[model samples]
Target: MRTWIRGLVLATLLLPAFPACGQGGDGTRPSPSIERPSVPSASRRLTLDEAQAWHGRHPRLLLAADDVAALRARRATQPYDRIAEMLLRRADEHMALAPADVGKAALAGPDPMPHVLQRLAMAGLLTGQRDYSRKAIAMLAALGEQGYPRRDRSVAGAGDLAVGLALAYDWTYEFMTAAEQRTIQRQLAALATEIEASMSPDGGTFGKLAAQEGMAGHHAVALGGGGLGLMALALRGEVNYLQSNAWQTTAEACLRAYYRDAFGSDGAGIEGFELTLRALGAALPCTIAMRRMDGVDLASATALGSVPAWAAYELLPGPSTLPAGESGGGLGSQDAMALMFAACPDNAAHAWLYDVTHGSRGRASFGRAAAGDASFAGPGAGDVMTLLAYPGERADAGPPALPLGKQFPSAGLAYFRSGWGDPAGDAVVAFRCLPRPHLGRWHLDVNQFTFHACGWGWAIDSGPGWEAADGEPTLTPTVGVAAHNLFQMDGREAAAPCGRTLAFVDDKAGWGLVVGDGSHAMGVTTFRRYLAVGKRDGRPRYVVVIDEIDPAPAGQAANGPQNPATAGEPPVHQYRHFLHTGAGNRVDLSGRVATLTTPDGGTGQFAVVSPPEATLKVAEIRTHAMGTHPRIEAQHATAGRFYFVAVLVPRAAGDERPIAVRPEGRPGPAIAFRVTADGVTDRVCVLTTPEARPPNGFGKARHRLQLSRGDLTQSLLFDLEEPGHDAPSAPDSAPGATPTPAP
Candidate 1:
């Protein structure tokens, strides 16, 4: 885990508990409610009768004899050779280290004894070295004498120790003496019992409710699925049959719920990046163990099979992810990717992502592979799991199999890019409009967006929240609307029921658009945002954003908190459209244009072309956790209705092209704009209201857009009220215009 996550965990533990509130009709604060999927009958608990008849041979936890033999035979190959040498070197390093103090380990590092023992045991099995096996046994015996994990500490310590000890014991079962084996088995059983007890309703850190609803928190996987499951598998026939069966049954139930509810149908983790990686890492051990010991593939029955693709899409141009929800802004564990690849060997995109992120020893040309000054040489590199899970003689499939844009409807996330494979050249945009807040981890900035272009993240999300070191009651601004690139109404947080994606159109011709309704998120009558990405001559050119906001009727109840002074009078809302840039970048505001300059000399201009009365202000927002960053706010106040049109152009260094942006078309119910740069002129028109249809003959359309560049013109129409209504084909072209149907 990273330092930020550790801090978050500590802060979460210390924070005061808030009242359990329901969804408020006033839209000031709403509780998150996730509709969990029904558990499949096939995932039901196995009876004690069936478990007693089950038997497993030694070394069947993660590796069989054939697997080890094949690994040894293929040790001369590329990744295999590198991985084998890495494991052997790690074993040598462990030979000099002393057993961890379980009490101290629980508070900070957690028990390292299990990891050390696991590495030594695997090295022994691979090399047939008695010294490695002897060291592992000695460490196991030393740990057995101690109180493995102090009961007063966090349950995570117990969970980690269980996983590590179980793996080590199972791998080295044949090497230990009879008495030593008996002692280790007893310790493993005790660890399992402790973990199970921690999930009890009596005094458990994670209560029984968490076990039933796996997505209740991360503890379901860390404690119930991975730790408990692995320990039970290791002690199956060696311990009391009923005790082992009960542990396995509970572990399987938790895992089933976790795999089903924790992730969306598209495999996007609802809890965001950091927690997802942590959960996946914890779940991998038991997933592999079950597959090897019982011939059951839990991942195959759930969305785990699609996780790699979702992960691939979440990755931005650099090391960070989209940072849509709660995140620490780093590419987490590669071991999870290794395990996913082993289970899904034929997914080309997965292979490409794994190779680009972890194939090399140091940083790859595109993404970060290892930590600073860290080599893939020790147990810290996760050499054992990598060696076991990495597919032999596989080739990276690259980006040909991936689409230029994708939309995960279940997660309400859409990503569009200009191109692929080259981080420095591609222009990417991520838009999020989840139905509701996900376990308080997701921000209130629904319809939020992040943009990356010219090798720099210009518009970014504020990851995690501020935590005061002194334990003061500090505000977490990052989780509020001010920290995201979106529109905020009356400076209030979102308390609406949900945000909906009204329409999505991704064309193969290098232009895409996403329309989202965030009225509920902003607690307004109507709030829709239209974001479009355009490419000129097969290269990223510009992005255009159109925002429409309409306040609720005078007599109607607004979504957020209303002024008490006004009482029942019509409310006047102050709408602030926000845009954020990295702290290292410099922002200069001139009239309606905000020019951002990167440290590497890259430049991007955000020009507001509509609502001529809007004012632009640039300032630095300082937070305790994320430091200081530049923020651009387009302030506009209106009681009736309003809309905004902005164009963003990212230019590489030394590209001195004059860009022109201006409002287009006569006054109407829609916002129209044109952006011209580098001899390419792009025009966009967005219909703001569905009831008050525009006079341009766009009949009965709930959402309508017209995009034109050169001689290609595409018109998209969507009727959000009618589900699964196929959009009509485009009308015949007029002169130079070639109308293309909506996708």
Candidate 2:
């Protein structure tokens, strides 16, 4: 891909820091500007001649020169990357072609001008060559004349410029004549100015490299802009840079803030894949250049997990598995991570690089660059997955393979995924709760959870998708139950005028919190709910239950409401199912048994009996006041090879009652199971009476069966192992096999 740059932007640095927000106890604010460390003497500095010679000797850096020539000879018979292989092969061809006499019309297509110049400068500095410097300068001049196209506000602009300057200065500073050096500096000055203007007024630059939504965009913009901005100024003498504290303070403040907020403590970028690459790439160069100037180490604040390997680990698709997307063209998250790791394998970030690149999938495409086409030449068997498969190097340690997917749901009905490395291993729990969309009016999902993982997350909040139809923010997680799987009255997604997250707590080792109530609460409907995580003896388990008591049933109720200003209810309904996004064995939900349907159509019932507490009252009302659509979906599938999971809805002991079964037929006991294990489990029962006095007072009858369980394993007449159609007839008291009268 051609490196694109727009215009010779430039600007002076600004500074401002009043109240010292640092260790400088003196009243005045410390310089927010990053101080670049002085380079060791001239003998150690890389010269232009040295850099160029290094490139000529290292053929791999040219991507695939020999391969391209060979591919061209057999173009008709070779594959797509062969063509991309060829384009890269002759990058020198394009570089030598020369722009049609300076005044010519601006050429269209992916311009390789900036890339060629940058590459040449790197080569020149490494080899200490004069010719490379001259060639690179010529390309830079052409690039400046074209006036780079405007990029949607981005962090890349500043970062790229900073890198370009550093390389250029490092290689050519000593070799160039007085006139040449002046010209080069002038060009850099202009670029610096333009980047400064586009930088966010709050302190970073803005430019969209990928889709302009989600955590990815924000991370890219901040780190990209911050790193680049710091480099440009740090390289220029600090005395020549801004003296005001505000400008310096703002830049420094944002650099740390963005790195911390977006990247997280684990070094994981908030947005997945693409953005993580951009942020890390930009941050790396900036970190290097800044440290070269200043003594500060950003790595101390950022962790090892924040590197490209973290991204790669998440991207790997196990052997024989198709890539995650329905369409395979988009960059695989793992591939991007591998590439970045190869480019920047410093000791601090080496571990992640080694672990990811060593994975089985990564081994297949090591040392391979994007061939401008899908289905390119893959990696060697051993080198393919080696963390250092980038030809010239190798990362230590074998690649780490993470478990593709494993999930668990919380009490407030919030869902979470655990044991990324293995389905059975203990894992971090995050929230998955969303707000209702009322009459098309949008809001962020509340009661959302954020998982804390090994400095990296295999699964994360998908983040808000502004473009999504419901207008519910994706991936912006909050803590609490008001906006989760549990019920909320009058349909409030945000809960209150300015929703706030209530108190949340979890004993790190024992039970953990799935939801809380800190956010605002609205309307005439609300429930006090709690969930606990504990091991029944040694078996880990989660228990959840919600208690809702509606004092005034008179208020309007809707299935989902859209507008709050109005006085009506919205039409919202709740349903649960275990969704399958990938190819996996199917599970059947028939009567009280959940049977796993293998890849072939054969059936194996894994769980046994129990019915759920079904309340039609909660489903009947529809709110139109807020144009919100409220809904809940449950997705079920086989768990742990085989295990029977019986779910119950009857209130624990205290609320047992003889609940009426409607219309004469249906599973009546308040218990249900999503079995994924062997052995039979019995379904037990009890009953409950209305809370307040009914029409006939406390004696009024309502036949609701409270549920309980018994041993169903190793039983003959009631074997759960039998398919639903083959299972023995139920006892006369049970609903389906016997005659049961309606209330």
- The per-prediction CA RMSD against the true structure, in angstroms, equals 10.8, 16.8
Q: How do the residues 1-743 of candidate 2 rate in per-residue lDDT, one tens digit apiece? A: 11111110001011121122111326354322222112221112223443333322211221223433443333243232333243334344434646443223123333322234344554444334466666666655555555533222244544444444444454444556666656655665565555544443533324322112111225444444554444343334321244212222333433444454444344443443344444544444444434443444444444434444333323322331111211121233332344444334553334434333333323334323332323321111111112212322334443334322212111112222233333213333333221111111122333333222222212123221212224443432222223333333333343332122222333232223333332223332322222222221222232222222221221332222325686453333332221111123343343332333333332322112212322111111111111122222222221111111122111111221221111112322211211111111122111111121111111222222221211111100111112232211222332222333211
* Tens digits of lDDT, candidate 1, 1-743: 11100000000001111222234444455534444455654344445666555444577777776677776776787667766776677568778755654335433442245456667888888888888888777777676677675433456556666677787777777888888888877877887887777654443645354454433435344445567888888887778877887777666666666777666567777666556665666567887788776777766657776766777766666542334334644555544656666666687766666665565511431111332212111112356777777774345466646676788765678888766576556677888877544452556767888887777777877666653234565656467777778877787776643476656767545467777777666666656677877665445567777776667732233433567876564557787888877668889776667778888787777877666667788877665434567889888776666667777777766765545554544425565554544444444556644433333322344555565532223356432223332222321221112332211
lDDT, candidate 2, equals 0.31
Residue pairs whose backbone atoms clash in candidate 1: none
Using lDDT as the measure, the top candidate is 1
Per-model TM-score, in order, reads 0.78, 0.49
Candidate 2 to truth, TM: 0.49
| Positional deviation of residue 597's Cα in model 1 after best superposition, in angstroms | 1.5
- Give the runs in model 2 whose Cα sits over 4 Å from its true position: 1-90, 93-120, 123-135, 150-180, 198-217, 220-227, 230-251, 264-268, 272-274, 302-367, 371-580, 583-674, 677-743
